[model samples]
Target: MTAINLAKDGLWKNNPALVQLLGLCPLLATSNSFATSLGLGLTTLAVLTLSNFTISLVRGLLDEETRLPVQILVIATFVTLADLSLQYWFFDMHQRIGLFVALIVTNCTLLGRAEAFASKNPIISSTFDGLMMGTGFLLVLLLMGTIREVAGNGTLFTNLHLLTGTPDMSIQLADSGFLLLALPPGAFLTLGCLIACKNVIDGALR
Candidate 1:
């Protein structure tokens, strides 16, 4: 297969979050705000890319027996780096996300690739897989974040200070936010609607 096929598989056809439904715990739990989702999504991207690279490098040395443990170790290492970086740089966002940020190490998408794709693939391919898969994950996170933020708070990018802006504040939306969208039930309902919409669009294209 060509590079394009790999891209298609990772980005749209076989995304960890949207297609395979992996890593829903963090996906659903922390996507109430655009900042939170973007922060987590980027961190997950870094972990997935780094873990994929490391796993591909060691694929030849390990057997199936030792690979899973080794893969987790690799993922954990990068996740720690991501976690500390967030703590040091974006301390507030780190505090807001709490343990969920560190838990990206345990996310199945990272391990799934280790066992399913990265373990057998070359480094270059594994890297591409990680990047595209992470992009897919980030895309879903951003979509959910947009819906949640707009619906919950009637704003798109409210808390810019967490990254690089003023503290204790945000640009308020002119209209009243839908309080229901901020709730847990709202997340489930919105996600279900998103999936249904995607399916309908796919069906229409077909």
Candidate 2:
């Protein structure tokens, strides 16, 4: 596929979180607040890009029987590095979503891209694909976080300083808001609405 097509597919047509429905565990768990969502999103993005590049670099050298195992090891290495970097640099954020950070290894989105795209594509293309896919996932997490945080807590970016070391950027919209949107069931409902919206938009385009 051309670069444009790859970008389009990853960002919109085949988004891992919104469309492909991969990595829902972390996506739903960490998307309760913008700060937490941003933390996990960036970590996942870094690990995805690095692992994809490394896997593509060694694709030709890997045996068919060992490819999956090698890919897991590469992903694990990056996850470990990402985990350490977060703990050292963003200890507060790490404490909030540290468990999910380690769970990036189990995210099928990373492994699926490694096996299906990285293994067959050139390093540059694989890296680009990873970036696009990771960005797509990040965008979804951000949207969900924004929706839930605003609707549930009546605040946006409360504690965003945890991620961006800035003065508090939060804006309180109300004293309080819907309690359901801040909970787990709210995640499912919001995601379903997002999917429906995407489908409607796609249909209109078609």
Query: Which candidate number would show the highest TM-score if scored against the true structure?
Result: 2
Worst 10 residues of 1 by lDDT: 165-174
Clashing pairs in 2: none
lDDT per residue as tens, model 1, 1-206: 46798788877778787778898888888788888888899889888988999999989999868888888989988988888898889988888886898889778999998889889999999998888899889988889988888888887776657876566445567476887887788788778887778778778989
Against the unseen true structure, what C-alpha lDDT does each candidate score? Answer: 0.84, 0.94
Off by over 4 Å in 1: 165-170
Residue 108, candidate 1: C-alpha displacement in angstroms: 1.0
Q: Model 2 residue 116 lDDT?
A: 93
The positional error of residue 58 in candidate 2, measured at the CA in angstroms, is 0.5
Q: After superposition, how far is residue 87 of candidate 1 from its true place, in Å?
A: 1.1
The list of candidate 2 runs beyond 4 A from truth reads none
lDDT of 2 by residue, 125-197 (tens): 9999999999999999999999999998899998889888898898989999898999999999989999999
